[model samples]
Target: MKIIPAQEFEMKRESDYGTPEQNAAVKEIIQAVRREGDAALLRYTEQHDKIKLIAGSLRVQESELQAAYDQVEPSFVNAIRAAAERIRSYHQRQKRNSWMDLQPDGSILGQIIRPLQRVGVYVPGGKAAYPSSVLMNVIPAQVAGVPEIVMVTPPATGGTEGINPYILVAAAEAGVTEMYRVGGAQAIAALAYGTDSIAPVDKICGPGNIYVALAKREVYGAVNIDSIAGPSEIVVLADDTAEPSYVAADLLSQAEHDEMASAVLVTPSRQLAEAVAVEVERQLELLPRRDIARASIDSYGAAVVTASLDEAISIVNRLAPEHLEIMTQDPMEIMGSIENAGAIFLGPYSSEPVGDYFAGPNHIIPTNGTARFSSPVDLDDFIKKSSMIYYSKEALLRDGETIMELARREGFEGHARAIAIRLEQEQASQTGGNDHEL
Candidate 1:
């Protein structure tokens, strides 16, 4: 890790729009699926995932879902079940009810909050299994009262004949109503456009490779997508009182995620900054994903030294990291000044992984510098709000002229006429006079 002054350190935000070839490939795949439906989906799966399947076999069987239990340990099942309950409970608090406000004029105005009828979650599969990802994406939709939650993963994961057992169990525990064995951009198209085997979804959520991200970007208008997620990031804002070892470990947690992932430390104490730089190098050698971590640390990791704790926080806001850990004498007090961060961890024990796996908060957070403008995945991501207005005759009549003035000012004669016609009829019914003249 390079130790540099705050003025010299610059946080890089890498865009994952993908190469032109990759974009063209994704576009071709999406168009093929749109034109050929299930045939294109099956062909792409065989070509990219090295698995062949018929339309009848696209959807995972109910027996396969139940039998997945026998393939995993009881301990694993218990943990996932516990995690699901916590995730569901946390999101349930965010659930909103449709509301209306009545006025003295007999007018009603409010918002109608309703969950999406159907949602598709794309879970990445192949050499790795992320039961945690399944739980993170599915439970929020379920909490928002989404009736049908569909999950799609590659047919074979970890060299197994079918999807990873852990992922299957997680999906089952999260109350997914449907599961499919399709993957890649093809799966995204099937979810967006629908096929003979998979019904279309109103929205799609989850993480995948460059192809998946591009596919989500391509099909956004047809269906809602969560976000084009970038690499993981963690920024530790520590003081002299912070433990170097703990700081180093927290930084490495994100570094091991991807070669492009960034792990940064912003602090005022020069001694602590040097200590953490050494500790990160020491711990990097021990990680199973050390090669990936090393590349990340070498390329993007940094220790920014500042003149004071306040300056350290200023740097953090500019970075707007995905995850932030405050390990100072007063972490809570410092958090009050933080304007940008997807998730904030206070004190030493509240590690990043605690929120990533067990702690109730969703781990699907805004990455890069996007935390400055966006938010983590929540119940709002699964539900939509429709504005409701019930204008009584009195209410419309009282404001009709004002409405017409504004509409006509905008050069919308049709809009003005729509309000004018109603106003004329209502005023004539009340008084035997033309409302337009009045």
Candidate 2:
């Protein structure tokens, strides 16, 4: 990590989002999968993942899922089960029910909340497996009452086993009803446009590599996506009281995630800044993924010295980081000032990994400054709401003129007549009753 003045470090866009070539490649992949269906999926699997597969083999079998349990240690299964339990418990609180309200005029208005009939969760496969992702993405949709949960991940390559056994075990533990052996942009397309073997889902939720992120953006309208997630990121808002080693370790946690991942520190103390920089350099040598972490720290990581902690927090809000740690003497005092960030950690005990692995909150947070306006994957993302209305004749009569005047003023005769005809018929029926009285 390098130390820079706050003014110099505030410059935006430290990383490249994507290239035109990548976008073009993604569009081509999406189109191919949509047209060729299962054939295209298999073709891409061989091309990208270095594995050739038949249509029948695209889906993982129930026996494979069961056998996955046997391959992994009992400890691994127990841990995944424990994590899934916590994740499910947290998300169940976010569940919502359909609501209705009735008025004295016999008119009813309400909202009907319904989970998506089907959903797809994409997990990155091959040598690297993240069982945590399976838990983070699947639990919310399940809690929302999704009927069918379909999972897709890349196949293994270079004579390696197909779909890491741990990922399969996690999916099984999460109660996934269906899964596939596929990856990258093609997998997203298969989810958006159904193939002979795989059916199209109402929404797709999960994270993947750059190609996966770009593909999600491409098929957004055809099928809903959780978010256009980018590389991992974290911003530590520290003070002199913050421990240098703790700050350095937390920053490296995200930097090690990918070469494009960013880890930043903003504090008012120059002494603390220098200490953390030294600590980060010393710790980098210990990381097995130090090459990736080194590239990230060299390119995107920074430690800025601000005039005051308030100024530092102001800069944090501008950056709108994905993860923010308030490692100060009193982390809570500064908590209220933070308006952005996908997840906020108060003290040193609430480290970033706590949320990433074991804690109840979803770790699939918004990244790349998207936290300014977007949110993490939650129960709301898996469900849809439809407004319900039942208007009685009396209620319509009471508000008919108000509606007609507004429509007529807008020069929409069709809209005004739709209301006027009904009111006129009711008035005529009332007049006939008066004639009988006379």
Candidate 3:
């Protein structure tokens, strides 16, 4: 890992997001799936994932979901159950009811919140099993009262025959029975535009590899999409009082996610920065995914020494990291000044992994600098709202002239005339068909 001064620090976008050529290839895949449907989906699945599948095998069978429980240990089941309840409890609070406000003129205006009839969740597979991904994506949709929650994950991870049992068990625990064995951009295509086996969904959400992320971007308008996620990133803002070992471990947690994943430490104390630099080196030697973490740390990781803790926090906002940890004399004091971050872990004990797994909040967070404008996946992602309006005759009559005047000013004569005609008719009725001024 490099220890660059804060004055010389530069943030670089990771290249793993894919080049133009990769994006073109993904576009071709989405178009092919749209044109060829199941045939193209099967072909791409075989070509990319090295898994040959017939149309009948595209969807996971009910029997397979039942059998997945037998393959996993009891401890795993209990853990998922606990995570599910906590996640559900957290999201249920976000559930909103239809509301209305009655006006003085007997007019009523309201918002009708309706859960999407169907939704698709994409869980990344290939590198490792993300059973937590299943819970994070599906539970919110379920809480939104969505009737059909379809999940898509890559099949044959590392050339294995079946999907990961942990993922299946998590899905089962979350009550997600409708799942697909297909993954990659092709799976996104199937979700965006229906195939013979899989029906199209109203919206798609989840994190995936670059191909999947680009595919989601391609199919966004065809079906609603969550934000285009980039590689994982974490920025730790610590002071001299922070423990170097805990800071080192937190930085490495995001780095191990992928070679493109970035882990940065920002501190005011040169002593703490030097200490964390050493600890990160020591910890990396023991990490199981040392190769990947090393690549990330070599290119993207940094230990920036700012002039002050306030300066470190300012730099963190500029970066708008996906995960931010504030380990200082008072983490809350630093937290109050933070303007941008997807998730914030305060103090020493609140590690990044806590929110990733057991903690109630969704781990599907905004990545890259998207935290500057976007948000983590939550209950709102799964629902749509229809504005409700009830206008009494008196209400429209009182506001009719104002509406016409504004419409006329906007050069919408047709709109103005529409209101004028109604007003004229009302006047004619009131005056025994003699309201000529109207």
TM-score per candidate: 0.97, 0.96, 0.97
Segments of candidate 3 deviating more than 4 angstroms:
15-17, 434-438
Q: Tens-digit lDDT track for model 2 on 342-429? A: 9999998889999998989999898878889988889999999999999999999999999989998999988988988888878879
Give the runs in model 1 whose Cα sits over 4 Å from its true position. 430-438
The Cα local distance difference test for each model comes to 0.92, 0.89, 0.89
Q: Across residues 92-168, which tens digit of lDDT does each residue of candidate 3 receive?
A: 98888999999999999999999999999897786688898889989999999999999888887524757887888
Q: Regarding TM-score, does 2 or 3 come out ahead? A: 3
Superposed by TM-score, candidate 3 places the C-alpha of residue 255 at a distance from the truth, in angstroms, of: 0.8
Give a tens-digit lDDT track for model 1, residues 293-312: 99999998999999999999
From the highest TM-score down, the ranking of the candidates is 3, 1, 2
RMSD of every candidate to native, in Å, equals 1.6, 2.7, 1.5
Sorting all predicted structures by lDDT, with the top scorer first, yields 1, 2, 3
